[model samples]
Target: MVVTATRTALASADVLADVSVVDAETLARSGAVSLADVLVHLPGVEMTRNGGPLGTTNLYLRGGNTNHTVVMIDGIRIDTQSGSGGATCQAIPVGQIERIEILRGPAAAVYGSDAVAGVVQVFTKGGQDGFTPSVGVGVGSQGTRTLTAGVRGAEAGWRYALALGRETSEGYNIQPAAYPDRDGYERNTASLRLGKDLAPGHRLDATWVYSDADAGYDSTTSKSSANYAKDNRALQRLSALGLSWQAKWSDVWSTRVMVTRADDRYATLPAPGAVPSYNTQTQVDTVLLHNRWNWREAVWTAALESRQDRLSNAGTQPRDTSRTQDALALGYGAKSGAHSWQVNARLDDDSEFGQYTTGALAYGWAFAPSWRLTASVGTAFRAPTLYQRFSEYGFAGLEPEKARNREIGLKYSQQGHEFAVVAYQNRVSNLITFSGAGACASSFGCYANTARAKLQGVTLSGATHMAGVVWTASLDVQDPVDVATGKRLARRAQRLLKLGAETGWQTWGLKADLLLSGDRYDRVTDARPLLPGYGVLNLSATKALTPNWSLLLRMDNVGDKYYETARGYATAGRTAFVGLTWTGR
Candidate 1:
């Protein structure tokens, strides 16, 4: 399989860094309801949520900040510039996703800012050679219902695909202690893709995706003693559009031009006599121009990118803001005898934060026929978000957060068995954090670059297939701490374990997964009690009824364990779902 870790495509076997891929078949077999479900099983990945299904979710990769990871959908950046500068992973529908590529470790040298930890790219379903149609319906716990339909085809020199889906659930209470009412959520999604071959080696493609949701949540700002029981609702909408043209100019040269636009809008309505309603909107526009050249033993790529970010808020305190960024990147990869190497460098000039330069170098040696060793060092940075710089309690003199990273990996594979181990360390400086001391010690504190941190971790993973069954397991041990006070970073588990087994016989298939997380602190200080560790089990089964039909059943949180990823939040208990799908070709 080809991977996009280096911007230019490379074979998975030739990559010198840690990477993971989740394809459509794997997603379908897992029967996951959200993207977070699939990512938590991967090595060096952790997720924390504030509530149940529709609550705010955050992902931490290799112990980095939630905003440190960059998210992309079909070459379009989908990271939001709202409250905390992260992707809205819960709002994305898994039914429309065809594949996901995860590149672990720092990738800022090739992807620019917001890549302090790694990168996640999602690819949606594409057109096929012939006319194909599919439909699915499912009903599950908590009065949940789902419906999805899609059609894809290609003929002559044109191809097209379209998908539509909807989901609704009368969810359980997310904040039982403070709010005694049940929360409910509803969502609708649509996606479209179109492409055409202009000439022999030239093609043009366009894609668009839309999602809208309404959900009820708890409010902590009410004045009345029973105000927490009142209703508080939020409406969210997202839209992404992209257009690109790719051409193979010669046997050794290729070029591409692409443009993308994304918009995110959210509105919150509080109970009467409580906090006033507010609306926030964020929009991003990006343009990319790239070229690649191939040689006997090496490949080289260069690209130019430009982006514009805009935000608008309407409430008692209204504001409007915008910024622009221009960047250039260069990358090279080569293989000689038993050695492979890669180098990347980038320079970004932001209209707000002057200029930043980052680079990375990696080397891989195949000492033995079935053994490989790799080492890499890189630098990364995260530019200050608009909210951090211009919000009501913002600070204008914040510097960009920066980090230096180093990693070493070893891999072994033989006879359908594979094992890998990787160790990494990252030291970050000028970390931006909220402070209620020094210059801004008022009621509304301001964000300041007043902290430093160090993160180090080791991950081990292995997989084996035998006797019609496959077994996979992974373990991660990490130490992430703040340098000044020697305190563990909040919401980051120090250890994690994941195990899975899958097997098939005749027309039936079964899969089971187990995840374990270690205790973690919920705040920067030790004054707050530590959140206890927890484990979850998930089971799924699929049976094929005919050539074009199938049935799926899934059970989540089988043990019905009560746990909290974040303090004062609630999690789902044991739940089950049954679904049926039909396809035509």
Candidate 2:
């Protein structure tokens, strides 16, 4: 289902945006433990982690800033409000997700604000047709262990699903050069979803998810502190709750109302005899109301949304602050013979940033039976984060970051093969950067709108099935640079390539993935050395012993290549995992 692109349920082929969908079955077969693992292979996507497993992870979509992307879980925004204005991607458990939708490029016209980059929406598992229960256990390298249990089914007029999971690991040393101590991690997660059909055209649904994690990390880089060799720890908690009601007034009209709340809590403890401990908590509440009209050749959508963000921290200025936003959006799509078009517009009033407007227009032409050409232009914006405006070194007068983007795409599909190529460019203004060169220089550093940037890229992707084997490949070539200084954006590679193959015979299957990344600068400066290129290979296999039981094995980092996505950070070397599962048919 396509929801992230247009904020409506439509077929993937009908959506006028670059989108990718990953289902639960695909996640299970890939043996991916984190959301980053699955997203890293997608086109126009990049991920950077500070260290192994439980590290601070960041995602950049189509060369946009880490905070420019919006993440939603079951229609609820879960972006963090602490010092870093990014989503808690590392804290989300994969087992609880039934599907993921990734939309690339500007989406502010449909989602507003942080959709400058794109949107990633996660949907949890729902009830099945009959009573079904499952359990699984696994052991992996670094003394890792995992346990999970879940049950879901439909009974009478009600449907419900519940899942619980736990994981712990005696992780390897993250900084073996300066700090040889291992950095372990532990996590617990629970998810529940319930839905009922009140009548033929009305429904009610509710969902909740809770996650808690504790992870160990190293101190700052050696150049920054003498005690950088010491070890530190952090604890995180996340909870999300959502409720929705839907009604079908008639065959041509439908409406939906939803309310959601998300809470994020984080605490950090210094190593022995080190700095003092600190904590931060963030809460977000949102309400949405939308109506849709579907006719023979056209569809129209209108939505109203209100959201409040509250943040409390022990180290930041103001200690507590809140921001509220109200938005209205209108969209229309139509199909005329072989040509289709879509237009969307949004108006937002933010308590801190004032009024803002954004819009997008897209067109598609089916030139041939199996070929299509598409083009789009859009505008997007990102409000300054609370920490950027209210922290001890923050600048309260900063303006919102904005961008205009355009793209053209060509797609072809025939038989069991599909291919697509898209080229896009984005120009950003009022770019916010942390600098100590202006009036706030004495404050160490403060965020200011002092720079501009341009990002242009080409993405190529294709998939084909032959002789019972499916092969997929994607390549991204881009130039992301600061317009004034002509410096490359930090941590964003100029080129990325991914290749994968999957094949199964009878009850046995095998899958392999390869990723290659070009050199990139750790900092956007001419003096910093470039981080060398790297490649990694992963392999996995599964064997079905019976109709109800299966065995799985996976090997990661087969070559044990040492690499770092961020300076002074260490990544996993060679690792392996083995597991078994039982299913009730």
Candidate 3:
């Protein structure tokens, strides 16, 4: 397996830094079978799921808001809808990913808005020399089954690829219920990529992708009702179209321009006696231009971007709004001897939230052949979403969330062994909250600055390869507190752990993984006990049956661990499945 962590002018292999790269092979071995499943097992990461196969899986990284984590595909932001702030990582299917590159720590200096937590970049697979056809089928616990197929190839001066996948499963309890779990889901997704060599020094690439999903949600947990079989339904649909052109104009300068558009529709229908269903349709369009220049030992990167969004909501309360934003960033970095230094600044002007500036500065020094030290300090800000700013019984003066962070880390890598640890603190102000979303009579105030939070944490992750086997582990310790009340914040755990190993022997493969999460208070002010510590185990094996085909098998949550990350939700139990894969050149 090979990890593609970063892509720069000088892209190198075997990088030693604060990062985690998941290769295609490793993804399959985990038996995660879903985007959210893969991330939950990573350190410092937690997920919230409504209940079902394609449920609303929201990710919280390093104690940051769900919208503070950026999702990118091939270096381009794929998230849409300013109201949602950020797209759900779980919306993307794993079958189309070639590799996943995760950059940890503050990245607002590079990306923007959502980089407060970090960045997850997904790169889709491309074509080889000849057409390759592949298919896979898996059946596991809870009446689960998945089927996927795809073809890839290169012809003429253009390379083209396509993939289609479908997945379904009868999900788990989600919460203690009066009846057996009655949640399940179905999804259909397809993606296409085409690249053309326009000139000796220029190229063009285009991608079109679409997904439609019908998923069930166990909405009973929200109410005190013991009738858990009452599951709502969610319909999610997304379509994206993008085009990019890259050209090398000279030895010292190069440029790339991209235009992208996305249409997203989300709807939730009540089950039986629930409130009337609601639906939201959002459209996002963006254009970005990036240019880089290298002058001797120093390099500069600058980008200009603009985005426009409009959303329409239908149901009990109808509303609509449109906003536009323009942003620009400039970064300078240089390498001298064994030290590297970087500085970046960015400015964003939003139609609804005024303007804000964010930036970062960092230094990396190599004192020894195999040891390096990095230190960074940065300031970042997130504009209040339209919903947070102007929803319902309005609070017109709400401020954007803001934070300042500082960190220092060390890295060491020799032979195939590597390790890194970073300690960081982020002081946040004006953290936005919807506590005021509670229904209010016409004469009462509905929104106000009700709370504030502080997040301090240390993250440690490492990987080692020895005797033809690779081992990896990560741990996160976080203390999230409500500064207003001097108490611990809600839904923030104190400890998180993950460990995994993979080995291959003469045409056979073996892998195992473990995930453990500690307990936390369910409410900040009330201090109610919620979830407890729990562990889950996953195992997989694969064997080559022929020159062009292989057989694979997996068991997920093998321990049948019963626990809830969310206050009232229960997770899935043990499940098993098998698949077949074929590759070609």
Candidate 4:
């Protein structure tokens, strides 16, 4: 089942949207500590990181800007109103996640704002019928170590789950030209979920997650002075809490009320003993009331949402600023025989930017057995972040970014075989960019709505299981361009290809993955030359030692390929990890 695409639960095979789902089993086998690394394996998804695992990271979906995507953890919206306004991917822990869903294209029609690109929903571990306890320890290359423990259970109409994890790594020098020093990184994570069944048709739930991390990097703007090198470290923390009530009044009527809060804190340590700089804190609070009516072959949904974003920065001019948005949304879905359709509409009122409305329509036709064709059209928008409007380089008159999208897809699924081909075109107006210093209080630059973008792409993917082996492949060809400059978007490759195979031999299970990409430019201004294309391979194996124990061995970048996702940043390079896991029998 999938719910992110339409804001309601439904069979994934019949949904008219382009979406992907990932389970816990696949995540564990990948051995990826960073959410950015795992998301890159999905079709048309790409990411760039500055230095180590806990470094500043950004994810681009279908060629959209990093801030265009919306992220949620268990029902809580998690985003930062500072630093260009986007979700902090490095703060999420892979060890605590149970499932993930990716919804492609504009989703502002279903969700209110900041859904101009897509949406990523993460579900953490939850309680089962009985107590289940687990523990794991792992060691990897580069002086890396990890420890994790979790427990979940249900008893007497009460359910609870808890998870804790820690990871540390001795990273490599990202910029040997200026600062030849080893960068280090460390992180701690925790998650909790509690629930109670009040009656046959009512329930209550509470969820929370916290992450704290520190990472080292090098900063050198000039080579004229070797003393300019500084061992900079980034300090970051994120926490989210969600509470909800779900009631099924009858077979045809259901309702949910939820409230959530998220906090993000960030700072910089110029040196080992220097005082932290650029300290900032961002807080978001949200409330939602949702109603659904399920009757025969049709479903209807309505939602009322309210959100508040506040930012406190010791470095910015204003020091403190805030904004609010309230929205109402309506949706409908129905299926008759082999035909299905979905419609959504939303209206938003912002305290600073006034009002806006968006809508979407999607249709699907099952013309033959195990085959479906889909088409969709939608519109979306994103409000400017508080930092972009009240900081030293801010412009209070900047308009919200807007977008329109159209797409079509064909899919076939049966048994253990699945295939899909999708094509889409999205255009964005009032795109924000940093321009000359004349319009703002700062002499360096100011944020302005002086750009436009065009993102068009085609993606092909397939998977099949045969002879105890599973094969998966996907290819993406895209054109992401700046309409004003006619140059391609920075760090986005025009072509990407990925392949994977999994099988079992006796008690051992094995897997392999390969990724390839085309050449890309480092900046939209063409200030630097084009970066060359690259490929990397990864392999892993798992074995069951006993009824309650398992062993895992994984190797990444098996070829030791030297590549850079960003111009001055460093990749993880070749690394190996081995782990032992234990579970209560």
Candidate 5:
């Protein structure tokens, strides 16, 4: 079941929003080390990463800004008030995740602020009905090595899960033009979850996850020269905790109360020094009360949320700031005969930004036996982060960014064959952008609302099971531009095509896929320098040696393709991985 679309569990086919779900099995088969790698394969998603998997990573959903997409762990939001004002994708441990739900349009009506583009919710692995233990080891290109062990079990109305993982890689020269050095990265992760049924209709759950990474990168600062190397590295930590109590009053009503906290920390130090040249930390705390009711054939939802964002910068120019938001949201959904409808509304009152409201309306019609058409319209807004308004180079008067989106979709589904076509246009005003100093102390740039954007796109996707194989494909054509300049958004391609095929032999399961992307602007400062398009092919296969053991092989970038998502940073050209897993079933 997917809950991101309307803040309540619903079948994927019954949802009116454009959405996708990726399970743990898919993640394991993708042979990806980071969340960013897996996201790029989804429809209407674009990624930009500096250096390698352990670099500054950003995801653009439906041509929105990096911060426009709201990321949640379990049911808690994870956003930073420092450094780009978004979640740190590089710090999330892929091995600990059980599933991911992605919504590809405005979702501020369900989630509170900072969902101008959409929402992504990640669920960690938890205990099932039986005891299960697993251990896996892998070796990959660039001297990469990985080890993971996990266990899940349930007994006597109690459930528990524990997972641990570690990975290290010897990377290549990330930015040779600035400083020539072999960048490397190391990460360690751990996760824990526990749940208990206190009564016949009451239950409680708690979860915690933590990861730390040290990654190498070349700095563009004046501390390094073309002939000299400072050997810069970033130390990062990400952690999240969630506690919830769920109660079912009757067959028609249920309520849940949850509290969650997340923290993001980064310290960039040069020359392996004891002191960090730059250090910052951001923490988010949230409390939510959600209620759902089913009457007749309709579903109703109401929720109340309070969130706080805090930022701290420790150094010679130390600073600390915080802000809060309180919100109330309501939603309704119904399916009668061949027509379905969904509506949602939310109001957020920020400590600094006063009040803002958002709403969404969607309708679906089953015109034919196996065909459905959907139309939706929504509004969203994002308040400025604390760092953007209180830092040395910040503008105190920065305003919230606002957007309105309209979309239509047509779909056909029968048995295991499915196809869809969706078209969307989003117009954003009061867009927060960095420009010449605006009443700030720094000579560099400061954040301000000085731009408008138009993001329009079309997506065609299909999946089918035929001839003993499953095939899936998607194509995206988008034009994301600045209203005044008419220049395309940096690092966004105009066209992208992805194709995949999977099959199972007598003893082996095999998969193959390809990616083709169009050209893009190298930098946001200018669109003159265009980065050429490129294609990459990947292959994977798994063999069951025994009931308890299995072997996996994967080859990425099989054609040795060369491409760059960012101008100076080099991409991982080619890579191969082999793994062995032992499961106690």
Candidate 6:
């Protein structure tokens, strides 16, 4: 079948998987300021946030732990060094993004470890047929201002692109009743891509990206005033470089290989006298190889992936750790009669966790001219992170978490409209319940293992196009239960809703979005009340003044919704920004 953005990839869907594609044009129109804001509209995806731009946040899929999710950029895996399994979306700004693909549901059979929750893959813009340059600036509510500029296209036998952008905002409060000011943040990002056609059958590409942020954090509780405590400043810096090569031997065979390295550092300070401080640095090296072959009756793909991670921390105490993992996999897919079938198997070896083998089977059948049905089942596992197994403050020896997932979905596509619905369930084993801060109080306290958990959910997502405009909607409902205690998993939202619409013309663009989530518990132990159901609106517009120049305006949280998130932590209030851009080709 011909694959398009509107057509869901069914092979991954059977085990209760769903995926959404957001192209460059849509990314620009969403006025998403950040990666978190951009992904909020995806079905079955939610965010956990704390107070401040640099605060910790995790992506929750079907009520899975944040560490369960895996993020990839241009085929390069990006994860924290501490093996905390948490990926900070704030590390990369939205303006540099070309497109984002969200693969929902369980992905362990394909990606190994962290794929237990889902996979988010991002592709950056590269050289085009010609050279182009653009720049823009904008200002808005909350003392917000933004500046961006970029150049893309090709030159000689080599294609190249570069972008530089900055965002700054005056502070806001974590809550209306609290005095501790929140919000003030400054971000600088730079990205580059270079590619060359080496020969008739070979190509080479290189990419580099760097981002830095200086932001304030609310150290006190919701009721604390800004005057009583100093504004806590936090910083996150990330730099990555990658190279890839691909070659085609013939019409039936092809090969691709890549190598990538990344370094990330995080730190937080309170005015200067704070006794407690947090700082960590991590580095990772990854290599991947993929080969594909085609036959009259079947097609096959095989891959080998490996990575090494090193982490170090310094403050009151010093720590060091390292980990390495390798995976080999093969897949076979064939078309017969009116149905397409796919089977895959993989084996993983980790220095820390022995080895694991996984497999999946899927089938897709056409029910009608414009309708299709798909079903799949897969198993995934996540090895324990260094922090989870050996931390200075609280040490725990935990086994890897395992999950089995199954899913079925339906899809319809015609003209410029598409619709899809998916239902999935994931059962987890060996859930780790660390000692809560207040549980038994202090250093002597120890944590208990929950043993097992289950999460089930259904997601309905669709998009329609009319008069050069696209409207998208998604709703997710998940019921997660603790199999051991028969209680609900804390912080797992029962309902997640996202809706958005956008229109783009040769010289004009406009968009709006809304996000809401049901109430969730804060701490797993006490189950404290965190955020309530809330909704927010965002809007943006762009107008091309000339072939190389454009004007832009953006407003975030336009409705000024006041709601807590991530354990009742204060969030950014409504804000706005304006910018201009110049492009050359």
Candidate 1 whole-model C-alpha lDDT, 0 to 1: 0.86
Error of 2 at 53 (Å): 1.8
lDDT of 2: 0.88
RMSD of each: 1.8, 1.4, 2.9, 1.5, 1.9, 3.6
Relative to the true structure, how large is the alpha-carbon lDDT of every model?
0.86, 0.88, 0.73, 0.90, 0.89, 0.74
lDDT of 4: 0.90
Candidate 3 local lDDT, 95-163, one digit each (tens): 887778776666766666657766777777776677887887778777888888888888898888899
| TM, every model | 0.97, 0.98, 0.93, 0.98, 0.97, 0.91
Instruction: Give the Cα error of residue 438 in candidate 1, in Å.
Output: 5.6
Error at 106, model 4, angstroms: 0.6
Q: Model 5 clash tally?
A: 0
Worst 10 residues of 5 by lDDT: 221-230
Q: Mark the 10 consecutive residues where model 1 has the least summed lDDT.
A: 221-230
The candidate maximizing lDDT is: 4
Q: Is candidate 3 or candidate 4 better by TM-score?
A: 4
lDDT of each residue in 151-190, candidate 5, tens digit only: 9999999999999999999987777566566788999999
Model 3 / residue 143 / CA error / Å: 1.5
Cα displacement (angstroms), candidate 5, residue 320, comes to 1.4
Each model's number of backbone clashes? 0, 0, 1, 0, 0, 30
Give the poorly placed runs of model 4, Cα more than 4 Å off.
Answer: 221-227, 272-276, 527-529
Q: Please give, for residues 1-585, the per-residue lDDT of candidate 4 as tens digits.
A: 998997788998768999999998998887889777789999989888777788888899999989999999987998888868899998999888889999999999988899998999999998888998999999999899999999999999999999999999887877655566788889999999999999999999999999999988765533345435467888899999999999999999999999999999998878644444678899999999999999777999999999999999865667888899999999999999899999999999999999999999999999999999999999999999988888888888989999999999999999989999999999999998887885788999899999999999999999999888999999999999999888889999999999999999989999999999888888887765467899999999998899999999999999999888887677878999999999986
Model 1: per-residue lDDT, tens digit, 297-320? Answer: 799999999999887864213377
